[model samples]
Target chain A: MANRVAVIGIGQTHHRSKREDVSIAGLVREAAQRALDDAGCTWADIDAVVVGKAPDMFEGIMMPEHYLAAALGAVGKPMFRVHTAGSVGGSTALVAAHLVAAGLHQRVLTVAFEKQSDSDAMWALSVPQPFSAPLLAGAGGYFAPIIRAYMRRSGAPNDVGMRVAVKDRLQALKNPYAHLHLPDISMKMVEESVLLWDPLHYLESCPSSDGAAAMVLGSEQAATVAESATGRRPAWVHGMAMRSEPTMFAGRDQVNPQAGRDCAKDVYAQAGITNPRAELDCAEVYVPFSWYEPMWLENLGFAAQGEGWKLTESGATALDGGDIPWNCSGGVLSSNPIGASGMLRFLEAALQVRGMAGEHQVEGARKALGHAYGGGAQFFAMWIVGSERPN
Target chain B: MSKIPATRQGHRPVAIVGFSQNHSVRSDSTSNEVEMLLPVIHDVFDRAGLTKDEIGFICSGSTDYLIGGPFSFVTALDAIGVWPPKSESHVEMDGAWALYEAFVRLQEGDLDTALVYGFGKSSLGDLDEIFNLQLDPYTMAPLHPDLVSLAALQARAVIDQGLGTEEDFARIAARSRRDAMNNPFAQIKRDDDVATLMSEPYLVSPLRRHCLPPISDGASAIILAAGEKAFDYAEHPAWITGIDHRIETHAFGARNLAVSTSTAKAGAIAGVGEGHVDVAELLTPFAHQELIVKAALGLADSVSINPSGGPLSANPLMSGGLNRLGEAAQAILDGRATRTVAHATGGPLLQQNLVCVLEGA
Candidate 1:
C-alpha cells in the first residue's frame, strides 16, 4: 500500500497585474518562504523541490527551474519541473505528493507561478504554425464558442454568467490576496462591461496577474512532527487523480468533458464519496470564464447534466449562506496567474479543511474538493482533502 | 540528510518491458512530432503484445520552444488516440524523468502498466540561440552565450586538470562513430581513426567537430510494467533496481564543471556501485562528457560503454536521455548483459543528472 500524505502548509502571493517590485525569482521565493515558515521548517527539512509554470515563452526563459534552483534551496537535491498547460499547478503538486506517498522522501516543497507581465501570454499561445489554419485567436476566442454551445444546450439565462461574475468579485473582497477586489460589484456592473469575446465580458474573464502558489506536502511521519511544532492540523489528502484526452477529436464533448468526469469519479472512489454535493463542504474550481463555473459543476458531478446553472441561479454556491460554498477565496475568476491559478484553488481547498482560511473559511468544513482543467479542456486534475485521515 | 536506499521499503518493482525508436536524422521535414511518434508508439505496443487500452497511464517529456508554440504536447497526444480519456501527465524534462514519474505512480499499486515517450526536433530552430534561454535570464542569458562555448569551458577544465587530453576526446568520438555503423537507427556512422579525427580543425578551443553530437530529430517510447505484468510483456524484463536524479546550482561559477557532482550523488543513491555492471549507456552529447559521467558512475573498465554509439552519433535534445535508458535496457533484454547502468544529463555543463541501475530477472 502507498504511504499516506498530507498538506502541512500553504502559501500564495498577493496577486497583481504587475509585480515590478520583484523579479521572477523573487515572486516564487515569496510564496516558497512563507510555506516553509508556515510548516515550521527550514530549507534543510525539504528533501526535494518541484517547480511548475506555463510555457517557457511566457517569461522568455527556457526551463527556469534550472535557474531558480538556488533561490528555492534545491542545491544538492532532486529538482523536478512539470508543465501540463494550465493544470500544471495541480499536477506539479500531485507529483510532489507522490514523491512522499511512494516512500521516497519525507518532505517535499512544490511551487507554481506565471509572471505574465514579463511577456505576452496571448502572443505566446497564439503563435501560428505551418499547415494549420489561422482560425485561432486568444484563449478567450477559442473558448467562447464552447461557452455558447453550453448555453444553447442548457438553455440557461444570459444573466446567469453575469451573476457569477458579480458573485466571485464580491467574494474577492474577502480575500486580501485576490487581484481584483471589486467592492461595488453587481449585476449592473457586469452587464455594462465591454464584451471581449462573444458572450464573455471583460469582467467575466480572469485577470492576467503575476503571482505564485506553494505547498509543503509531507508523509505521515513528517505531518505528525509539523502538527506538534505548529499546533495546526494538516489537510490529509483523501484522494487525487488526473486524466487527459486528445485536444481535438471528432464527437468530443467540450462543454462537459469526459476527462473531467472520469477524473472526478476516480478521486471520489478513492475518497469513498458517494454524494459529492452532500459530502463536500466546499470547492475551489478553475473558472477563468464565468460560464465555466456551471459547466464544471456538472462535469465534476456536483450537479446533474443540464441543471448546473440552476444551482447558480438558486444561490446554492454562494459563500454567505449557500448550502455548498464554492470559490470561497475568490478563485481563478478573480486572480489568474495562468500557471498558479490552479494551485490557488487547491491551496484554498486545503485552507478550508484546515480551518485556516481567516476571513473566507467555510464554517465547519470537514471535506473539500479542488479542481483544475487545461489544454482545450482536455486535461483534468482534481483532489479531495479532509480534516480527518482516511481509514 | 539520511542516505536514501536504492529501493525503499514497500516500493514496487517496475521493469522495462518494451522499447522502440525512430531512425535518427538531421531533420524530419515530412512529419511533425505526432506523426513521428505514431509509429514508435505502435511499435512499442506491438513488441510488448499489448494494446493501447492496456496502458494504465501515459506521460511524455518535451519542450515547446522547438515547435515555437505553446501546448505542443497537447496536440501530440493524438499519437496515443486517447479517445476514452486516460490517466496521464507531462514533464518539461527528458523522457527519463517521465519514466521516473511512471515508476513512482506504479508504487501506488493502482497502476500496472504505463507508456513513456519523448521527442524533439532540434533542426526546427536555431539550437545555439534557443539553448541560451536556459541560462540565468537576469545574468548569463543576457550575454547570449551559446551551448558550445559552455561545453568548451568544461572540456578545458578536463584537459587542464590532466583528466584527459585532446587525443582522448578524438578516440572517444572515433569509437562512437565506428560503433554506430552496426546500428540502423544511428544518424552518423563512420570508420575514422583517432589520428584522422585529431587532424580536423577545432570548432571551439580544445573541441573538434567530431566531438559534437549530431543535430538529429528523433522520438522514442518505452513500456513499463509492475509485478507479474512485467513477465508477461517480456521474456527477460530489465527490472529497474534503482533510480535517482539530482540537480546542482545553476550558477556556472559556483560549480566545478570538470566533475559532475550531481551525477555522483544520484549514482550513489541509485546504488550504481552495489554490484557489477556489464554494460552502460551514457548520454554524453559532447564527447568529453562521457569521461566525466563514467567516472562519476565509477563503472569498471571491463564494462562496455555506448555499444549503440550513444548520443555522440545521434543526439535529439529531449529524447537523448530516454534513448540512453532504452539502450541500456535493451542490453539486458537481449541477454548481452545481466546488469547495466544508464545516465542522462541536462542543463549547460551538466547542471542536472539522472542515474538508473537495471538488472535482468
Candidate 2:
C-alpha cells in the first residue's frame, strides 16, 4: 500500500512589493525556518528538498537551487526544482507529497518563491519569440482580451469584476501577511482606478510581490510525531491532480479552460467529492485578477457556466456570509509573488483544515480545495485536504 | 516511544521502454525548440509502440535562460496536440531530473506510462555568463567566473591531490571522442592520440580545448512503463533497479574538488556496487571530472564506460543527463550489456549528482 501523506507544517514570508531586507536565499530561508519551527523539526530531519519558482530569468539566475543548497540545508540530500509557470508552487507541493506518499522520504521540505524585486517580470515575460507576435504589454494586456471574451460569452455584467476586486481586498484587511491592506476598498474605488487592461482596473490586478512559501510534508508516521510535538493536527492530503494543454490551438476555449476543469474533476474523484460547492468548506483558488473568481468558479465546477458570475453577484463568495467562501485570505489579489502565489493558496488551504488560519479561518472547516493555473491558462494543478485522514 | 523505522518505501518496478534523440548540432538555426522536439517525440513514441494518448503522464525538462524566453515549454506542448489535456509537469533542471519526477509519480501506482523529454539550444545565449547566474547571487555570481575557469579549478585540485594529471584528462577526452565514432547522433567524433591532443593550446590552464564538451543544440526523449506493461513495450526492457540523487554544498571551496561525495552517495543508494556493472554512461562536462565520477562510482577496469561517447562528445544543457540514461539503456537493449549504471551531475563543479542502475533479466 502507498504511504499516506500529510501537510505537517506551513509557513510564508510577509508578502510585500519588495523585500529589500533579504536576498533570494535569505527570503526562502525565512519561510523554511518558520515551517521547520512549526513542525518541531530541524533541517537535519528533512530527508529531501523540492524547490519551485517561475522562470530563472525573473531572478537573473539559472538554476537557483544549486546556489541555495547550503542555505536551504539541502547539502548531502536530494533537492529537486519544479517549474510550470504560475502553477509551479502547487506542482512543487504535489511532488513533495509524492516523495512521502511513495515512501521515498520520511520528511520533505518544499519551498516556492519569486523575488520580483530582483528583476522586471513584465520585461522578462514579454521577450519576443521567433515566429509569434510579440506580447507588447504585460500579462494584463494578454488576459484582458480573454476577460472581454468571457463577458461577451456569458453576458456578465460589467461590475462582476469590480465586485471581486473589492471583496478580496476587504478580506485582505484581516490578513496581516497579505501585501495589500486596503481598509477603504470598495467598488467605487475599483471603478475609479485607472483602466490598465481595459476591462480590468489597476486595483483589480494582483500586485507584484517578493515573498516565499514553504511546507513540510511527511509520511503518516512522521505526521503522528508532528501532532504530538506541536499539539496540532496535520492537514491530511486527500487527492491531487495536474493537467496541461498546448498554449495555442484553433477553437481552444480560453474562457473556461478544459485543463482546469479536467484537473478539478480528477482531484475531486480522488477525494470522493461529488458536489464541490456544498462539500468543500472553503477554497483557495488562484484569482490573480478579480474577475477570475467567477470564471474559475465555473471552470472548477462550483457553478454552472453562466451561473458563476451570479454566485459572485449574490455576495456568496465573500468571507462574511458565503458558505463556500473562496480566497478568504485575500488570495493572489492580495499577495502575488508569482511562483509562491499558488503555494500560498495550498498553504492557506492547509491552514484552514488545521484550524490555524487565524483571522481568515473558515469556522469549523473540515475540508478545503487549493487551486492554481499557469501559462496561457494551459497548466492546472489542484488538491483537496481534509482535517481527518482519508481511508 | 514508537516510530516508523526509516525504510525505502513503495518500490514499484519500472523500465525504460523506448529511447530516441536527434543528431547533436552546434547550431541548427532553422528549427525552433518545438520543431526540434516533434520528430524526436514521434520517434520515441513509435519506437515504444504507443500513441500519444497511451501515455498516462508527460514530464519535460528545460530552462528559460537557455532559450532567452519564459514558458518555452508551453509552446513545446503543441508538438503533442494536447486537446483533451494531459497530466504533465516540468522541471527547470536536466531531463534526467524530469525522469526522476516521473519515476516518483509512477510509484503512486495510479499512473503506468509516462513520456519524458528534454531539449535545449545552448547556441542561443552566452552560456558562460548565463551559467554564472546559477552561482550564489550575493557572493559568487558577481565575480563572473566562466565555466571553464571553474572546471580548471577542479582540474587543478585533482592534479594537486595526485589523483589525476593533465595527461589523464587528455586520455579521457581522446577516448570519448573516439567512442563517438560509433554514435551517429554525437556532435564531435574523432580518433586522435592522447599525446597529440595534450599538445593542443589550453582553453584554460590544465584544460585543453578537447577537455570541454561541445556546446550542442539537441533534444532527447524516453518512454517508461511500469510492471507488466514494461515487458509489453520492449523485448529486453532496461529495468530500473535503483535510482537516487544527492547534492553537496554549493560553496565549492568547502567541497573536496578531487572527489564527488554526492555521486558516491547516490551511487551507494542506487546499488551500483550490488551488481557487476557491464556498462556505464557518466555525464561529465569536463574531461577531468570523468575520472572523479568513475572513482566515485567505484567502477573497475572491467566496466565499459561511455560506449555512447557520453556528454564529452555532445553536451546539450537540459537533455545531456537524459541522453546518458538513454545511451546506457540502449546498450542493454543492443545486447552489449545486461547491467549498466548511468550518472548525471548538475550545479557548479558536480555539486549535485543522480545515479540510476539498470539491468536486463
Candidate 3:
C-alpha cells in the first residue's frame, strides 16, 4: 500500500437552486473538467472514478450511476457510485482515498453532485408508505427541532446564528464559484427574515443548489507526477477516519452526536494531535445551517462543551484574525450542492493546506482539517492535511 | 462430497462474516427508510457476532426513487438507532457498491470490521417507468424508453449474434422459476413450465413476464470483517479475499449490447483466472443476460448456476446483488460447496458489474 496519498486537484461548480440550462451530466462535467485541468492531466490519467450523490429519488433515477458513468469521463474503467445519505460527498472522497490507501489504484477521480431542481426533494424524501407516521415535511423540518434543542440547552442567543449567516455570505463574495452571493447580506437581513423552521430563518439555511465538485486524488507516485505537470505541491494527507452509529436509538443526542466526536477523535489520534483547536491551522467544516458552525464546533471538541456558541459570538472563527477560520471558502451556506457539500469542505481544506486559496487563503496555514457529517449527524468523514509530510 | 481436493488456485477468497436482510414483500407501508431497516439489521450484527459498538464503519447503498423518495438514506437512520453517533457514511448505489465502500474503509486500517447493506422496494410506484428517470432526463426519459425494452434490445442483440435462441431463454426462465419453488423468500414462484411461459406472450418482443425479474420489494445486509476479526465473527465466515467492480458506458448506441466486458475485467481481478466455480449465483434479471454474464466470467460448463433460483426466481432491485452473496454464503454454510463466485449487474446492458469470490478458507 502507498504510505501517503494527496489531493492534486479540486474543482466545483457554481451552486444554485435550479440548473435548467444544463443536464445533470453537464453539471457534473463542468466540475470534472476543471479538476482535470487543475491537475494538469486528461481523462486517461485517471485510473478509477467514484461518484456519490444523496439518493435516487432526489432525481427520480434508480441508481443513475450507469447513465452518469460516461458523463464523468468514465467509459471503460472502475466506476463506483457511493450513497451514504447526505455524507455521500465525504464518503466518495474517502472511498477514492482508500483505493490509493489500499494499494489498489494510483490516480482516482472522485465526483459528487446533485440537481434538486430535477424533482421535489420534499416529496421525494417524504413518501407516505404503508406503515409509520410522517415525520416533519422535509429534512429541514425534521432537523429544526434538533437545532431548537441545541439553542435551548446551550442558551445560545439567536443573534449568534444571524452573525454566522452574515459572516459566511460576506466570505462567499471571494469565491467566484459560490452559488449564493448575497453581496448585500448582513445580520440585519438575517434577523428580519422569516423563520422557516423555528429559529432557522430562510436566510440562515443553505440553498438547494444544482452543482458538482470533483477532485483528482492520487497515491505518492501519482502526486509526484502531478507536481511536475502542475508546478504545485499537493496537499499531503496526514490522517483520515470515518465512523457511524445508528440513526435514532435510545438516549441519542442529536444535538451533539457521538459519531461526530468519535470521528474527530479518531482522525486527530491518527494525526497525533491532542488538542484540535491548537494543533490545526485552519478547517473547512460542513455548515449547511449557520447554527451548525457552533454545534459542530462543540461536537469536534474544538471548544469546551456548551461553549461552542461562544466561539462564534466572539469572532474567533473569522478568516482574517481568528485562530481557526472555519469555512474560509464560505461553506455550504454560501454554496451548496447537497451531494457535493461535504466534498467542498474537503476541497477547501486542501486549498488552504496547498497555499492556493486565493483571496480567502488563511495565511501561513501549515496544516488543516476537513470535516463533514450527514444523516442526522450519524456519519462523519474527516481528514487532516498538511504542507509537511507525515513521519 | 465430490473429492476434488479443492486446490487453492481454483478457490477464490471472500466470505460472509456478517449478514442482515429486511423482510421481503411487494410493498412496505413504512414512514421512513429507518423504520424498514431496523428489524433485520440486527441479524447482520448478530450473525457477524459483533455489536454495533464494535463496528468500525458503516456503508449502505439504496436508490432514493425506489420508494418515490429522495435522500432515502438520510431518513433511514431512524432505524440505524444511532445516538451519540458513530463514524458512518453512505453510497447512492446497490448494496454491492456499499460492500465495496465498506471494503475500502476496511483497507484504511481505521477499523477492521464494517457493516454494509442495500435496500429497495420497487412497489411504491411504476418502477419500470420510474427507472426511466435513470436515463438522460432531457433526452431519453422524455422518450419514455422503459427498462424492459432496453433489456429486450440486448436480448435481441444476442439473438442477432446467435448467442442463444429464444427456446434456450424459455428453458432458463422455466428452470429458474421452478427452482424458486424451494426458496421461501421468492415472490414469483409458480408451478409452471416453459411451454406455458412461452404461450403467455411477450411484454416486449423476445421478452416475456418469465423472462423479466419481478418488481421485488426487499432489503439485504452483509457484514465485512477485515483480517483477523473476520475469523472471530463466525466459525466459517465468508471472508472477502477477492472482490472487484467495473463499469461501462451508458449510451445505448455506444455500447456493445451482447456481452459484459466489465464483468470479464472484474472477474479476472477477483482471481477467476483458473478457478473451477462450484456454485455461481448470478444476478441476471433477463435469461439472455445470464448467458452474457456467464460467458464474460468464463465459468466452466459443469459449474452449477443460480442454486438459489437467482434473480429470475426473485429479483429485488438494490438488494439483489447482496442476495447473490447471501446465496453463495448459504451454500458454503451448508457444506454443500467449499468455494463459489457470486455476481451482480446494474444498469442497462449491465453497465456496472461486481464480482465476489468466496470460499471456506
Identify the superior model by DockQ, candidate 1 or candidate 3: 1
Name the TM-score of candidate 3.
Answer: 0.93
**lDDT at position B217, candidate 1:** 96
> If scored against the real structure, what TM-score would every candidate get?
0.98, 0.98, 0.93
| Candidate lDDT (C-alpha), each | 0.91, 0.91, 0.79
| Per-residue accuracy of model 1 over B260-322 as CA lDDT, tens digit each | 999999999888999999989999899999889988999888888998999999998788899
Q: Write the per-residue lDDT of candidate 3 for residues B184-273, one digit (tens) a residue.
A: 878666777778878978889898877887777787778776655666777666655477888888777877789888899889888775
- Which residues of candidate 3, in runs, are more than 4 Å off? A122-130, A135-137, B1-14, B18-39, B45-48, B74-80, B190-192
User: In model 2, what are the clashing residue pairs, if there are any?
Assistant: none
Where does model 1 sit among the CAPRI classes?
high
Docking class of 3: medium
Find the 10 residues in a row with the least total lDDT in model 2 chain B: B1-10
Ranking the candidates on lDDT from highest down gives 2, 1, 3
Residue pairs clashing in model 1 are none
